[model samples]
Target chain A: MSTATETPAQHGLAAHSHGAGTKSVKGALDRFASFDVADHSVPHGREEEWRFVPMSRLRGLHDDAALDGSDYTVAVDVDPRVTATSVGADDSRKGSSTYVPVDRPSARAWAAAEKTFTVDIPRDEIIERPSVIRLTGTSADRGAAGHLVITAGRHSKSVVVIEYDGSSSFVENVEVVAEDGAELTVVAVQDWADDAVHLAHHHVHVGRDATVKHAVITFGGDLVRNGTTLNYAGPGGDATLLGLYYADAGQFIENRLVVDHNTPNAKSDVEYKGALQGKSAHAVWVGDVLIRKEATGINTYELNRNLVLTDGARADSVPNLEIETGEIEGAGHASATGRFDDEQLFYLRARGIPEDLARKLVVRGFFASLINRIGVPEIKDRLMTTVERELAVAEELAAEAAGDA
Target chain B: MSTLEIRDLHVSVETENGPVQILHGVNLTVNSGQTHAIMGPNGSGKSTLAYALAGHPKYTVTSGSLTLDGEDLLEMTPDERARAGMFLAMQYPVEVPGVSVSNFLRSAKTAIDGEAPKLRTWVKDVKTAMDNLRIDPEFSERDLNTGFSGGEKKRHEILQLELLNPTFAVLDETDSGLDIDALRIVSDGVNRFSSGGDKGVLLITHYTRILRYIKPDFVHVFVGGKVAEEGGPELAEKLEEHGYADYVGEGAAV
Candidate 1:
């Protein structure tokens, strides 16, 4: 993996060249320069983690700038107790905020156009209730991009839901931080309107003894790429990543997750499940866990399971574990992808369930185990509704195929 | 007349031994509001009969004619058969993980009845049915058969039978895994459905304990995919008392 550090001049970007309104851009550039971006783009296929991912997807995105703002209206059906506060550029510094600029010029320009949003759970405040933060883009003429930063303070616990719903094809980056002794549950639902292209990056940092549970549900967009990276920075910290995704009829959804155990006694559990249907619908899940040598007492496990709903659709799953030390209590990973089980289908059908309903039943059941793990009734209910809606769409597509046949 | 007529029913399944015939030349008639018990040893094709009647794709009826109330039953799909007033309370009910029993039952009722039942009436009906079976109303919210005890699964099957109100029900060994109390509750559910005066039941079982609660009007000993003996409910008692030793010889003959 190339870890080369590139100066702004090498990338053909002059400092403060974009004009007066670009002060945030300059600050972003200064902050991002401290991190290694060139090495992050290493297309190393020798490692098992990047074996199945089509690195070619990153081809045209290398020099893309931040997308411009679109006339999109975000639709939100959230709990009444939860407020959707929009954090404009002026309000960014009021709370604990971390910012990372995109290396690509296009993503940088897009982020510069749309104001950033921040969701904050006050310090030491425990809101046993759940809340949602929805972002919708409606730009039809051009691509869009923005940044979301969330913070959970010390001794505080709460659930935050972030949904991206819109008509624009764009890129998104979300960075989150959980301070010491804080607990945060974040659910991201990406159900963009058709004709949208999206690439999203989620970076999470868990402080010492803190806990973060994150889940992603993807069911829309033309070409969607979701990348999540979590670093357990504090001792005794834990992170759990659970995701459910479904694609059908010409939709493509790809997810890549990397969990880094940087501190000792840090634990991580990752489970992602998905289903694909219709002709040429593709669903992919790539999970990688790296247990650093110094993280001796770290315990981690990951599992990715995919179900193919049709003969023409395909699912790809890759789960990798790199353990530097074996002193951990337990560590393992499993990945499997296959078509529907005939035995299970027959089992339901034999009970007087129609083939269509039986298929829906089985697919719902496949995700039931994960839904139970969500631990939030509001989010769980919404997940069920979204899953059922997707199934309904799949059935319609299947009916059309049958009609064509 | 409410009658389940199976004429020259032949069924086969694809197995390691190639296409194996499980049901051969089976013939039977079950009348309305009457209980009929089918007793057979393991691998005697009792469950195959249930699957065939329920239109399971694996149980291909190569040569058979099944009619319910004079309508061609075998010609319909499983869901269509269910809508046509046939219910199969499976011996091993499938564990549907996410679908609650209440939701599944409501959907099944809508499918069978061709319309959604009224909310007020539906709730009242379900509550009354659950009360009669001595089942907690909270069971309705639980996922269908998912993590349910064996006895709970049996009771759930009966709950479906009562709520769906099918004209003819094929209970495929509903008593196989039930204990004494569970057997009584399950039998009580079946009795409530049968007492409706418009329903007919075909109870398949290996034990006669359930029959003690929901008495059968007729008993047919199924062996080698054929009814080897037919008698009154006394045959069930006889099998329970003396075992199937005397009938196995006759069952082996064509």
Candidate 2:
């Protein structure tokens, strides 16, 4: 029941001030003055989705030094059929493409300074090779923020891969638009170093008859939060969101996804799988689907599954479906968080397979079906690399567990 | 000589109804270079015998001694049993989705031998084994038993047997769900693995179809979780002709 026009102070900004700022920050503050970032605040452990996540790890004060020029770099690999362009927040000709600054006197101060980068795909273009954006951040003292915007023209087909790696803690925001008759695939891989803390927010808009597939792989980071929101604006549009995460000892990864089926004949499917090992390793998967009153004949399904590898490790999974209209075609959601299946493990071990290798095999098998659904080869390769690395880490942790036992 | 001996093996499983005995007073022995076939009706503890021998956790031995080549088998863990030269071709092989068959076989080989296999020899040996089993070389790259058809899973099990080269193997009803062609191929792989002098096999099955390919030196009929009858390969033909009606009657009395 909350409107977008509500003021930040009204939504829990009493702790901070909307003081005077630079012209650019002032404009954003004025435009979104009624928007309350606290509306999005989910108190740690109080919300079911954040139960197993170590939010305390990210609640401490972060260094605010600006990143040095050499500390961050952006590289892109695009298909021959598609052209890539980097547009800053000031680009005006691209209507409705203005970047929203995260830092300001607003309630969303924790996410401040996160900027958006934009990419445009022309009409009728079929991008065969996946476009890869590699962001390498090497700052040791200061945090960084980056933004991305992707637009697929009508009847166009394209793939985009965004890789995030840096030394410092930071936040990122990505926005994607798929016009009518367009098909887009966006794959994000976060392979930051062990010391880095990353928070990413992704917003996607799907037009009529458009198709969008978004996949994320998280294997590295001390603490990471990747949030995705998909809004189907036009009827007959389809959206799919898939994610895989592996976190070992001392690593915390949280994923939150919302699919808003606002129009009729729209379909959305989401599947996220994760594995956690080590003493304090933790993971969370939150899947929310909203079927509005006008969205009749909607088909929405979501599934979240997590595997806990050790005794102290934890996983939280929440799949919620809100159906405003009972006229939908089909809607369902499922959530499961469980320790490794001992019966399955024994079944494998009985085959003469070692216990360690057997557990790894089962975990890999659990994610293979979803990984195969990723049509892009580059993204698939990247996912495999992340999976292998996580498996290696799991093995090391298992060895340590054995040593302790 | 390599041999697997089970001395008065009694196995039970923990269930909601409390502990229920599955195998009661079972004893058998299979010497090196010999094939032994065990046949029984469903619920007669055929699978339990196999699982107990493989050291499955669910089957706890109340009283038993399993030894492989004079080494205490029950004293070691399942992995240790495999490393100690005991292999189990599972009745229902678990599907491993992400690990490739090649990777799984290599890891098993390394674990068994306590060292990594020489890459060149390992690859050659794997390729030869795959060729012998009529399996496509590309299958090695596929996930272990993931998405495999019933026949393909059985063939993959045989491939493991061929690659691991354990001294003693327990083939647990591998021909259950296979078509005739797949059954023949799987039987061929088992026969190939048993061709060497140091290999021993305890083949457990409900049907006598597999025995037509790999003849058994001895056939034992299991009833009431105990060996009710023991004879040469002729006993298999006798059971195939006449079902386990008489055995069931005798088991009821006992």
Identify the runs in model 1 with alpha carbons over 4 angstroms from their true place: A1-34, A44-47, A62-118, A128-149, A165-183, A193-197, A203-212, A229-240, A248-250, A258-273, A287-311, A319-396, B15-18, B229-254
Looking at model 1, residue A219 earns an lDDT score of 79
Residues B8-92 of candidate 2: C-alpha lDDT, one tens digit per residue: 9999988888989988899898999899999998888988988888788878999989888788888988888888888888877
Q: Which candidate gets the maximum lDDT versus the true structure?
A: 2
Indicate the residue-level lDDT of A204 in model 1. Answer: 84
DockQ of each: 0.26, 0.32
lDDT of 1 by residue, A342-370 (tens): 66676555445677777777788788778
lDDT of 2 by residue, A1-405 (tens): 122123332221111112221222333223332234444434445544445656566533222334222368789777766666665545542324223323221123224433446677889998787888888878635555665778899999988888888675666667788989999999888888888877776778898999999988888889888778777767999999989888888888988876767789998989898888888888888776676668888777788888887778888776665545556666666677887777667756654567877777678777775787766765666577677777777778778878998
Scored against the true structure, residue A281 in model 2 reaches a CA lDDT of 85
TM-score, prediction 1:
0.74
Q: lDDT by residue for model 1 over B119-214, one digit each (tens)?
A: 999999999988877778999888778788888778878888888888898999999878888888888888888888778899999887888998
TM-score of each: 0.74, 0.76
